[model samples]
Target: MEALEAPPSLAPDNRSVIFTLSIHGREAECSVLREALEQHFWVQPGAGDARILKAFADGRKRITAVAERKLRAHSDEQIVLTSADFEVRT
Candidate 1:
């Protein structure tokens, strides 16, 4: 994200942080795992984005599994990810 912020020329299309996981293992475990990853990123200085977008899910659990996130909106979200945003894509 700092790399993005460093350049005034190409303002990133929001915070383009993408999280992808193929949870053939325990879906529940991996869902939380993904959250931890997101939090890890959020701990950065300018890691806070205005919006969070999760675009993958596990049908059985109805929880987020993967995220193609862009968090540069106005309204802010703390940690707004569910397990329904992920699916087995591999």
Candidate 2:
């Protein structure tokens, strides 16, 4: 991740400095995280995989760790968190 230059209109100060974060090479992880959130928390029952939902019942942290490990093994880029990844590991 890199910080994009702040707009000239926004002046830097001792209190705060504003800048946009430029992220790269992690599209796969972002997609996984979004899918997990939608499937696990935003969807009604019967809308997502039963195994994934069961894994999520274990805890958010466990699910997130599984997702990160899966991504690390598959690619060089950093990963975001997800619940379905826990199901896959189990």
Candidate 3:
């Protein structure tokens, strides 16, 4: 995340703020999510992958929570979530 300041040549009152957000590499995780989506929804493959990828791109908190839950369930041995973990029972 970065913010750029207005140039000095610009009038103070007319100045506008600029913000830039950059997301670093997560290729492996994205691949895993893609595979999971393909396996879970064969009829609509790649559909849910976009939503999950967008969640990652937007830095949603739910993704972190899911990871934390997975870690806790594994007693810190590993962090992993299978298709079942993503299913809603109800």
Candidate 4:
């Protein structure tokens, strides 16, 4: 799985859009895109089973509160949004 995942949307400029793509080539055919994804990296969160592994696995990490808003779909593959819906995160 990717360390970070972002849905494509118009960038902060409101004219340009950034896309998140997965590598599709072998070690030789992929270089440019690989470097681009590496340059924008996000650390993975530690999510372990709460019974035992959770405490021991990442006991040192702080758990942040996450507020979730249900995502609605406009189509089978598209999302419904207005100009106010665009959000870019690190």
Candidate 5:
């Protein structure tokens, strides 16, 4: 990410960018959704982190959006999916 290329004077390490998703669905639906996320975004599993399903740069927005749109098709009155960004101290 461009932030990684920033000079130490800019203090890139002072902040972090994170992408997140929250979905409400059955177990089967959740599994399929996870696969869809990996297929559409530049994400890798968050190792042992349970809160983060995947992680990627802001530059991956295009594909992330496309994947979100695709997942919309599977939504119903009971299923919900959403994403948000957070800037936090590193």
Candidate 6:
């Protein structure tokens, strides 16, 4: 029998988005896209089970643009958004 293990954790300061990806045309292109996103988002520093893009310093649109540039297909992936704070606009 296998022993139970504890689930990984996230930092209290962390905020990010999760994306599912797919690479078409060439398999090698996938790494290129991943590298681009890492350069763009800087990925979350330190260890965790989560695969997420670090929040953009500028705002939400910048993050969306990054996703727009990287996402090649409309049907193959998912992006989950989270807000650090909840706000009501008039």
lDDT of each model, Cα atoms only? 0.28, 0.39, 0.35, 0.23, 0.31, 0.33
What lDDT, from 0 to 1, does candidate 4 have? 0.23
Full ranking by TM-score = 3, 2, 6, 5, 4, 1
What lDDT score goes with residue 6 in model 2? Answer: 38
> Which stretch of 10 consecutive residues in model 4 shows the poorest summed lDDT?
61-70
- Give the per-residue lDDT of model 1 (tens digit) for 3-80: 111111111554333332222321111222334324433333343343222322212123321221312231133223
Best by TM-score: 3
Error of 5 at 26 (Å): 13
Q: Which pairs clash (backbone N, Cα, C closer than 3 Å) in model 6? A: none
Off by over 4 Å in 2: 1-32, 42-59, 80-90
TM-score of candidate 1 on Cα atoms, chains taken together: 0.19
Whole-model lDDT, model 1: 0.28
Q: Which candidate, 2 or 4, has the higher TM-score? A: 2
| Residue-level lDDT tens digits of model 2 in 1-90 | 432233211112211111222335343432234345455555343343443344344333444445445555766554444444535542
lDDT of 5 by residue, 15-74 (tens): 222233333432212112333334344445442223223333333454334334544665
Q: Tens-digit lDDT track for model 3 on 25-71?
A: 21112112434334443414434434544434343344344544554
For each of the candidates, the C-alpha root-mean-square deviation to the true structure, in angstroms, is 15.0, 13.7, 15.1, 15.7, 14.9, 13.4
RMSD of 4: 15.7
lDDT of 6 by residue, 1-90 (tens): 111122222334443333322234322111112223344445444524345432332333454434444444333444332221212246
Q: Which candidate is the best by lDDT?
A: 2
- Model 6, position 81, has a per-residue lDDT of 28
How many clashing pairs in candidate 6? 0
TM-scores for the candidates: 0.19, 0.29, 0.38, 0.21, 0.24, 0.24
Q: RMSD of model 2, in Å?
A: 13.7
Q: Per-residue lDDT of 1-90 in model 4, one digit per residue for the tens?
A: 121134333344432223332222211110111122222222123322232222222311111001012111121232222222323556
Off by over 4 Å in 5: 1-19, 22-55, 76-90
